[model samples]
Target: MSQNGAGVDLETSLGYLLKEASSALRAAMEEVLRPLGMSVTHYSCLELLAQRPGLSNSELARGAFVTRQSMNVLLQALERDGYVTRPAKAPVGKALPTRLTPSGRRSLGAATAAVRSVEVRMLAGMTETEQAGAFRILRSMIRSLNDGDGNA
Candidate 1:
């Protein structure tokens, strides 16, 4: 704690710690994905599609935490490269559902392995119980933050 108490104590702040952890994790993931010609968002999109096929662009954008316009640009490139496919016309509304091509699946397989390695490395010092506790704690933090009103 600071004597003046004028601002946050970054060393003991949970928000600062969480942001630091997130940044480290992102850097590690990027290092592993670089050789595979994939970015974090690209891998996220493919992983999401593999788990949930027929996801619309907007849905994918949300899942990947990118803007819809950025996702659309990526989708266009993926479609052009035959990594994914969307129907010529929407079966329902203007939302075009996307699916992974065989190539995309193969690519995702490698990316998944890489990501798993990073996660394993990050959790190397933790026991099963500790990991479970961490999961619960992190989920609680997320829920609490999301459930809060504007006024803290």
Candidate 2:
């Protein structure tokens, strides 16, 4: 393996591995989410809002690892679909907060079940200890790649 301009070897690059794994992960998650009438993107937004309960579009974007502009476009669609609400305008005249509607919560709850089912299948070959160790190793690798900057 040789380092190129980006300081990664094509033959043994973390980016390549991560990209492939992420694609697979999304595909599996999407398979589960689709039956619940949701895309992975929409489910992610709903899950984030469910957890934080009133995040601005920008904040939700960052938390969900998406661009602010992209998040706003999705939010608009969700709002139109009656899956989310924007409440009143923000006090700072900045980004308004978004939250899931009852329907969104119900749909996301169903999708969450499907996601867990996929996770169980993905981890079927591993023992509980091995699963934890795998999670630790991946987290360490991500931390090393991110350093202190994160994906921001």
Candidate 3:
């Protein structure tokens, strides 16, 4: 309990701290991404496409942590803007596999550099070993939460 017996001792609560850290990380990413006319979700989508090559709308939505409808809207804009491409019709089921165009890959390269700077700044104070340990701990926490919710 806190000194005053509050509902939760946020100063020592890992979950509270984790949420705070996530917020800070997001703000920092947004600050960097704003000048490029990209949101975190936008960059995440491009980055996912860069790595995965041909991911479906729903798969990209899940990976980017956005709703399928939202992803579809973004995909439409991306396709119109010449950043991504989809077949005239679905190659297999109802899902159209999405891929990045050359322009999209070029855009992703710039975003990747900007995002990497934020990550480097965030990890500046941590030693390699400490960073590795933190990675393991954070992954464990994610697994625990996801598993508990049957989403893992």
Please tell me which predicted candidate would have the highest TM-score against the true structure: 3
* Model 1 error, position 6 (Å): 2.1
lDDT of each: 0.95, 0.85, 0.94
lDDT of 3 by residue, 53-106 (tens): 889999999999999999999999999999999998998999899999999999
Clashes of each: 0, 0, 0
Error of 3 at 9 (Å): 1.6
List the candidates' TM-scores in order. Answer: 0.92, 0.81, 0.93
Worst 10 residues of 2 by lDDT: 1-10
Q: Which tens-of-lDDT digit does each residue in 1-152 have in candidate 2?
A: 36466756666876788798789988999987877778888888988998899899999889888899999999999999889999766857687978788988887888888888888887888998998998999999878768867455
Q: For model 3, which pairs clash?
A: none
Ranking by TM-score: 3, 1, 2
Scored against the true structure, residue 78 in model 1 reaches a CA lDDT of 92
Where does candidate 2 clash, by residue pair?
Answer: none
lDDT of 3: 0.94
Task: List CA RMSD, all candidates.
Answer: 2.1, 3.9, 1.9
Report the Cα lDDT for residue 59, model 1. Answer: 98
Candidate no. 2 TM-score: 0.81
